[model samples]
Target: MSEDEHETEDLQVEVAGLLLDHVHAPLLEDQHVRGVLPAPSEAPAVRVALGDRGECAPSRLTAYEIPLGAGEELRTSHDVVALLRAVHTGTHIYLSSRVTSVMGMDLYLVDPAHVKEAPFTTDDWASTLLRCLAHPSEERPGARLRGFLFREGGLLRLYMDSDEVPGVIAADVRPGGALTALLAALPSLLGEEWRTSDAVDDPHCRSLVDLTDW
Candidate 1:
């Protein structure tokens, strides 16, 4: 693995540790988790909660720098925690590495999430994550979902695909209510080319691609 990959794994490990440390344990389970999930409906309107405490810990800097050990970079626990929280929440993506390396990592993570039973591969990851990020916001719910990107040679890849999935089946919200609004918004976000030719099957359900950039 490259130095960057090593750092990302370190970040994930660190974040997993935090989930074990900070976030209330009860919340991890589906029961007390409340409606972190979406409601059930055909189509419903939703708005991006700008005021939501959208944050990235170690926000100022992702990876640490060392010099001679002087200008080198190091990863921190806070960075990992932030990424884990975002992923667990179904937020889009997050990172724990320096900005320069993030784009590449994103590409690496996408395949594992989208390819399903198919084996994850570098090319699969590249296409999935790149398409997701390259796609526009209307195609997705609040673009506020965030994550880190890592560099792979010259390309930017998504390292993590967070919980951007709308809680369509959870509670209160109908299945596709919020997702429909987002889908409606996609044509503009990704330009007319992204307009889905097929009719929405369930106005309430948010397709995996609908929530993320892909």
Candidate 2:
């Protein structure tokens, strides 16, 4: 899809909100959408506060500035994965405009990468589970997926049992692919760098990982 087509303001706000709720960090006094950007400039964005994660450093805090918008900003699962992969203490992203729409929810959500997987959103983890459990047949009905979603520490995680698989499957919210595994891999991915560096390690850096529900 073109950049213009990918801008989903509601989804962006929802994603930012997920990060705020689940990312393990100390929220600064100014971490809200309005708080992050004072009056006049106030726009839609997720201001995240994160704990430092260097294995050998003293305690410190970090905040991530993630901007939500359309085509001009982080537009793909790959972009998000790379952003998470590269952040140090935290990262900054800015969507050029604000979300002013007040539209109702859509009947279907299609992931750019996986048409078979339909992801839904709610205010938080508890509600997400309530949705999955509310129906024995799953909200999707005959769809082939029985997945429950939740957000925790920068990750939107999905724990599911599929009719096609004998064991449980743990997934992050994403288009189906290897990118889904990046969150759990952050520790080791950072570790490889830690092992070779002489600088005092930041534990936060070593442990930071985000998620999504499939």
Candidate 3:
């Protein structure tokens, strides 16, 4: 193949991986992501008094360099699909790089109290968590939710002390929401039990890739 063609291929591969991360970050961190599953039109949202906002609203959400070590860098669109499927299969995908950013999001903990309350299953609680983050606000446009880190065996605990609960979720509040298009493609990934160590078989995550648009 010609050098220019190869370079373009490399670029596409890198961009594809970025696309995956863009979507993966929010799903990992955002609370009650509403659409990961099919929601009914009349469903009651898992409502809680919005946390004491502002004082806790943070400037940056950082991920430990640890969990990131497990993410895989995908090269093809199919790889992206494989990862997305994991969300529905009781599996998860974590941000694979050291590039966690400052963004506004909604994140809540596994409120054990809410666990037994009827009609809504754990799925409803998780969906509510996502909706709170994705809900519209004035700080940004298009409700650009971004960089969500959970507490207790959460996605970004490497940077947090062992005592923090209900980690922060933030909005892109930045330029393009960077992964706006990508995040739109997946569903909420919030129902997993926290405070426990579990292993996931995620093919969509990797440390690096041989760039080829193949």
| Candidate that would win on TM-score | 2
In terms of lDDT, the best-performing candidate is 2
Candidate 3 lDDT by residue in tens digits, 32-116? 1122111123221111111222233433222111110112332233222223323323423433452333234232222222222
- What TM-score should be assigned to candidate 3? 0.16
CA lDDT, every prediction? 0.29, 0.33, 0.27
Stretches of candidate 1 above 4 Å error?
Answer: 1-22, 25-71, 76-190, 205-214
TM per candidate: 0.19, 0.29, 0.16
Candidate 3: C-alpha RMSD after superposition: 24.0
Write model 1 residue lDDT over 109-154, tens digit each, in one string. 2212222122223433333333444454444434322333334343
Off by over 4 Å in 2: 1-8, 17-44, 52-59, 69-78, 89-140, 143-175, 178-214
Tens digit of per-residue lDDT, candidate 2, span 1-214: 5443334444454455434433343222222211121112344333333343322111233333333443455444223322332342133233334212112211111122321212222333333333333343434432122344444554444444434333333433432344324423422333232223321333222122123332
Each prediction's total of clashing residue pairs, residues at least 3 apart in sequence or on different chains, is 64, 25, 21
